[model samples]
Target: MDMEKEMFDIIHTSEFSIFSLSQLPHDDNSLLLGYEGKVKSFDGRTGKIIDLWEMHEQRVNTIDVHPGNSNLVATCSADGFVRIWDLRCLGKEQPKSIKEVAHNRAVQSAYFSPTGNGLVSTSTEDTIRIWGGPHFENLSIVKHNNKAAGRLSSFSAIWGWNDSYIFIGNIQRAIDVISTENNITTPLKSEYMTNVPCRFATHPYKEGLLACAGGGKLFLWTKM
Candidate 1:
């Protein structure tokens, strides 16, 4: 409750209103923020903005830094573009996009696989696209029911431990898993899951556990 209230206040503050945030890998003191159409890096301890990069025509919905390469970061936005940025190249007024794909519609989430060789993105409608290969081309399009969730932090497809399994919530009160290698869809249902999960987080050490949040509650799932 306290954290939610704090976030509510922060979102109302124009100077601190953030659409998305990301933590830079291997750098403990730096943090990344997607404010409006710009990306900024700040000193986490001092609340000082160090650098900024212009990004996205619309608000960035999600930002995911490549797990293997910290220099490679990805973002999806309402502007219908999913992009990868090389953080080594920065310009607040003219940020360079290393690579991008035109979704042609608002994208909700773009996440890199744990191996960082693959990427998975969720759209506002019916498609979940997976990108891979040397250039991260559009590899496959999987059908999914993602039209339900509406808020800023809504149904997002996420990766499990390795690069094989992807997790996303459905309206049926179950978690859906999409296999990247075999291209199979599976549903994970539990009687304890009463509400549809909208957001997910993973722990660094506990690779076997995943947590999901919705309805002001959190559910932790373990692989056993």
Candidate 2:
């Protein structure tokens, strides 16, 4: 189907394309959105754009509010940097801290780990880089593939389970569960999905309930 048809399908299914989305800490009623380089906070149910900020030099690739700190927001961009911003501050204020080389290449995705201790990011460089905190500093970069060419296309997506294990998805239509318990490299089980996921989100209050946007359909996975 084409774009119009897709829109119709989404409307019928009670969903829409999200350019970039983040849930406010402790307040599900508010959402932070990044669309076309503009950031806005809105009432989730009413669709009201409560606050707006436009400071990114390029299109925003990701937007995440600090899990325990509602005042802070983190964003990554095509410009090759990750930034921590204090949303409580006013307009025209730049990010509190900007990591100029947060990623070697365009950051494809970024997210705060569920436990609120740090951030997990992925880039087109085909590597997953973990930052110790929202500052995007004190980082450790994990190369997903040992081979050079393989690493180039070996992109990744990440989600956390109690900060103990992070579920990573990739273009290969496979998921890798990484354990943060020992900071060791061990490959766990992989789930073969029907298609590369277009979007993914974990349930805030449920165990093993994964909301996956893939294969032109939505899936809810439950743990056995």
The lDDT for every candidate, in the order shown, is 0.82, 0.63
TM-score of each: 0.88, 0.71
Instruction: List where candidate 2 sits over 4 angstroms from the true fold.
Output: 1-18, 26-29, 43-50, 93-101, 133-136, 145-156, 181-192, 211-213, 217-224
Number of the top lDDT candidate: 1
Candidate 1 Cα misplacement greater than 4 A, ranges: 1-16, 149-153
Candidate 2: residue pairs that collide: none
| Residue 121 in model 2: lDDT | 74
Once model 1 is optimally superposed onto the true structure by TM-score, how far is the C-alpha of residue 60 displaced, in angstroms? 0.9
lDDT of 1 by residue, 38-89 (tens): 7777785676787877788888888999988898899999888899988887
The TM-score obtained by model 1 is 0.88
Clash number for each model = 0, 0
Per-residue alpha-carbon lDDT of candidate 2 for residues 121-199, written as tens digits (9 for 90 to 100): 7776767777665454667766664122332323445665676666655445544566655545554223545654445
